[model samples]
Target: MRHRHQAAPQQAPWPHRVKRQHCRGLADEADVPPAISQDWRSFRAALVAGSRQARGGEQSESNQTLLHLQDPVLGREAVWAHSIPDAEQGGLLLATRQAPEVLMNDGLEQAVVFLASHGPEGSLGLLLNK
Candidate 1:
């Protein structure tokens, strides 16, 4: 029941937040069936979608849920490096998040910090500036 967002801290750089744990989660989820885990492509799309959404976790998450798509291509780039090993990719630049604001935990009225997650409580993000 462990999650990648567990590494996310309220205050941490985006790079550090994108630890191996996140990649490992992505890799692990890739193996499971869609019934158990979300499809890799759909998951990535949700992240980059242009609307706020809840992250995949418990069924009853509050507004603290983390997910908001801004750009699918950018999220695709960012996720590719983590989900797929370099050996499989055969040498490519690391994918990075180019947008400033990312996933939101709640409605637009809620505060959204695109820096990190709630550390074991929710998702974390890499700094858009960094």
Candidate 2:
């Protein structure tokens, strides 16, 4: 027995639509690679933990540093919050010894990246010490 399928009529004659639909159907949310998914989970957890720590009512420790200011009257010094901010535009990404050698293929190792844009969409950077 032979069965024949009929082609559906196109609302608009956009040839690329079929290809886009086919590609979208080939992968679903669960298709994300395990390593990337795990990394994302870890990053989210770190962010949540950092936020909770920042919101805690614990007073800053009395660590004296060059940036601290001393009050002669109260004999108290200001303690600045020691937190590394999240990545932002105009920030620099410095590669360290822990950088993988494979990054040398793109000259990213031992190099610095000047982030031009960083947002939910993605990040764009230019290599400074490449």
Candidate 3:
């Protein structure tokens, strides 16, 4: 059966509980697709052999541009860990691409979010689907 519903957690946080439901048959730490299940021994061997992929600029490079919020609430926004957002700590996060006049449909984008933590800057959470 498809695990589309959140399962009872064995000490999981609320968000992870939700993710567990979302990634159901697609992926998991110990669960592999049925097609690959039969050849897992070979798969494991190949994975070990090809591990530590060849390093290069293309493989090591990544970039991120912070999106700003227009009408951010005070003290509740997710800020990039390296900098302080105008929201301070608890405001809403808005992506630069989101148009203020656009009618958001079914939380289709990461245009808005709340900062759930302060130190170590945990995950960037968007309560769209939920």
Candidate 4:
């Protein structure tokens, strides 16, 4: 007589990465569990908290990562938009006039770029709607 073979235990998938893949249109939610979703939310909150700390005095009650720049011309409320540090791969980058430096040599004012890569190594994106 021979013994039956046993399968190894399955490992849990990373909810954060899975959610990103979903946003990138690379994965479906059908296979995800509810617990994973909750875990993702917790993880996101932690990240947002860290972002707030990283920005030093800026604070936001909402989950959106925002940056407010003072108007140089009119000297009024200038621009309020998502911070560049929040950019991710496969995400869209909207060039803002308040940006510290010119985004591109061709002029990124009111331009959009597709983020191909984003990380500590730096970023690379494709210009769009030129």
Candidate 5:
């Protein structure tokens, strides 16, 4: 009896290598969900509005900036202990990026002073008074 050699199995092509046509009409087709389309439209509108607002100076600090603080230490004892400058005693001071100043209370307890920036949803603050 003669022995017959079997052919090797063919390998499948990679999915990444498959060619696809641009579905230009798919965007207009009613097959797309209404909610998905609405979401896309809203996203596009927001992007455009943001770009326009940015260009129109609506995002400037004078227009969009606000200050916030928590647990403020005030009065003569707090001031003397912290060694805060006389001029800045009762005023809000902008926090420096470098080493933040340490603030102390009459009880000799220490706290960090901070300047806060607030937005519509949230706020960020830097400790400047401690």
Candidate 6:
């Protein structure tokens, strides 16, 4: 006696794909530049001063802070400057800005440099190594 084989059931076609509707109200929010704008030199000076203040026992009201600097080469000059607790012994600590690409890759490109002490403070970095 020969046995008959049964065919497998087929799946129905997927429903017509519909594009998602996204809200545009939030997307229209314009980027407002900082009130005080300055050249690279002036910007760097401000950053250094702020770091010094924090180092000189000046406690920031808000533990978390976002410092914005306006300069021509923001992509290059802007960095998360930090001051070691000890000025003379610890010395100035400079962390090179890291970009998104650097963070995803190994040290193949420039490594995403960050301050070792940027703890509790919550830090985000950008790559400055062009």
Candidate 6 off by > 4 Å: 1-31, 34-48, 57-130
Preferred candidate (lDDT higher): 4 or 5: 4
4-106 per-residue lDDT for model 4 (tens digits): 6866666775222434554654445666677666576555556666776767846343422222233334434423333446788877887666543764454
Question: Which RMSD does model 4 reach against the true structure?
Answer: 13.5
Model 1 lDDT per residue over 16-112, tens place:
4465565743666456778547465566445544233333322323312332255545544533222222122122232224322343322322232
- Candidate 5 residues lying further than 4 Å off, grouped into runs, are 1-36, 57-130
Q: Residues 43-110, candidate 6: write the lDDT tens digits.
A: 65577777787667444434233222333345344344444443232123333345335446444353
Best-to-worst lDDT order: 4, 2, 3, 6, 5, 1
CA lDDT, every model vs. true structure: 0.39, 0.60, 0.46, 0.61, 0.41, 0.43
Clashes found in each candidate (C-alpha, N, C closer than 3 A) = 6, 0, 7, 0, 10, 5
Predicted candidate 5, C-alpha RMSD? 22.0
RMSD of 6: 16.5
Could you tell me how far off, in angstroms, the CA of residue 1 lies in candidate 5 after the best superposition? 59
Candidate 3's C-alpha lDDT?
0.46
Worst 10 residues of 5 by lDDT: 75-84
RMSD of 3: 17.2
Error of 1 at 123 (Å): 10
Give candidate 5's error at residue 20 in angstroms. Answer: 7.5
Which residue pairs in candidate 3 have backbone atoms (N, alpha carbon, C) closer than 3 angstroms, thus clashing?
75-89, 75-90, 75-91, 76-89, 76-90, 76-91, 77-91
Q: Give the CA lDDT, 0 to 100, for residue 38 in model 5.
A: 64
Candidate 2 lDDT by residue in tens digits, 49-123: 678687874343463432255545343542222333588676678776657564655455678888887889788
Tens digits of per-residue lDDT for model 5 on 1-130?
4347866666774212322345444454376678657676465456556666656623334312221122223221211112223223233344333323343224223334343444464444444544
> For model 2, what is the alpha-carbon lDDT of residue 111?
80
